[model samples]
Target: MHLNYTVGYIIPIVLDALKDTELSGDWWDIQPGVVRLCGDTVEERTKNMDKTTRRWREAQRFEILSGWRDEIYTVYAPKGSPFFYMERSAHPLFGVLAYGSHMTVYVPATPTTPLRIWVPRRAAGKATYPGMLDNTVAGGMGNGAGPWECIIKEAGEEASLEESLVRAKAKPVGFVSYFYVRHKEAGGEAGLLQPEIEYCYDMAVEAPDSGGPTLKPCDGEVAVHILMDIDEVVANLKNGKFKPNCSAVLLDFFIRHGIITAENEPDYLEIYTRLHRRLEFPTR
Candidate 1:
């Protein structure tokens, strides 16, 4: 659905941080209260920005890397192959909402059964969005990995899934795009811009004894994996138990699976349109 919340104005500190960088204004466009990087190709612009952002982070002492400081995420233009790599921790500081992908796994309800979904709770000690409910498998796309590759890696790491099963069963089901301006209460520096496009996928697991592997938290990032009925999932969504973006992903699942349709919802069209809101950056 279209985001019901308003994006907060860009905080001054963010702009001030970008002021002196060689990659500022010249490499990025700041207008209409939004910031977007510009370059002929993803590689050229991303490389320049990565170097500039790294140097700025070091000089400014914004050392909250939490072990992700060395990890690199591929920054893309509006679409297509990645342009370059950037330290994962510095994405928000520069107001660049890097693109990532997520997968929703479920077992279709039989005539006598109810639909069930897999949900994971973020670890309490995580750096961002700690103790929040997340999708079955979610992660940022890093350099040299495509969407499918990224999902497989995340699925194995976060949920202990077999790579062969993931490749054989995962089905890409479009994406969910939103521009989120996180407020201080949401657990980040106030006015941190997080424009993102989540390339969503769906995986239908077989019933037990069909050789489907059980899901368990293999990585410390997830505390537990809970299987909840569709009704219970919707309840959690309404109660704000799921992370905001995860909520969007689940809502999309409902729409696509015929669980949420125009006959039952008053704002069905509006919700569908809102989920794919056209972003202003990267000229996509």
Candidate 2:
């Protein structure tokens, strides 16, 4: 029930719910319905944790556990308890967590700097997700690991990012919980979305080195990534435009880290009051 746990098929919305709530634990989003997939096979899915996970069900879990992507309710469990355990999703040996994290990445530097950030495009033949871009790094948290550990692991898997570098730049931002229910678009209340809660994190990296490992395409559902304005890009989302899900998470991260001001209203150049503002970029 920690206010950070999220319950939703969509990770960002879950985070938003957590940010919006005043309560702190085992809570869920008040969604109208669950997400549904096309055809059979992947349809009619349910949340069934393993024996180890089932054992933890009685623990005073503060977050969601074991579920699918289009699910509604997140069977929440707390940390240091057994109500949850890790298992496979999409693949048997893939070892995705019953609980996990979703995080955001920012531009290399201030808006005035000639730096940039990238977002992934949804691929051509996606199965469930058609053309919706998502976070810079996201992954299922496994059993026995901490939320920070889950985020660090996800960064490596989703973006091929370096571990220590991610750790150095990232820190906890918030949590979200996805509740279960059914809707016309989601098929039915029985067809809730997956991953009820997403532990969120935020960071500012030192613009990645080109020679470093790049973000590998996941299952052809994602297309080539892109670079654009944080504000301009996200605004496109309202018009059905495609932007990475984690972009706003990045904005949130900046806010939590005191990087983004409450007023992006004026613009990054308004800092001229002190020609000697402590704006310095380390030369690596």
TM-scores vs. true structure, each candidate? 0.81, 0.49
lDDT (C-alpha, whole model) for all candidates = 0.74, 0.44
- Cα deviation in Å at residue 161, candidate 1? 0.9
Residue-wise lDDT of candidate 1 within 1-284, one digit each (tens)? 12122222345776765555553436655656665555565576666667666666556534433334566766544443444567777676655556677999888898987988888999998777788889999987756567788899999999999999999999999999887776543454656677788889999996555665678999799999988799989998998888888888888999999999999999999998999988665521
Tell me the lDDT of model 2 at 136.
66
Candidate 2 least-lDDT 10 residues: 275-284
Predicted structure 2: lDDT: 0.44
In candidate 2, what are the lDDT values of residues 111-190, reduced to their tens digit?
56644455666665543334666666666554445678878876776666678878887878665443223232222122
Alpha-carbon runs more than 4 Å astray in model 1: 1-10, 20-48, 59-68, 76-84, 185-187, 209-211
On TM-score, the candidate that comes out on top is 1
Q: How many backbone clashes does candidate 1 have?
A: 7
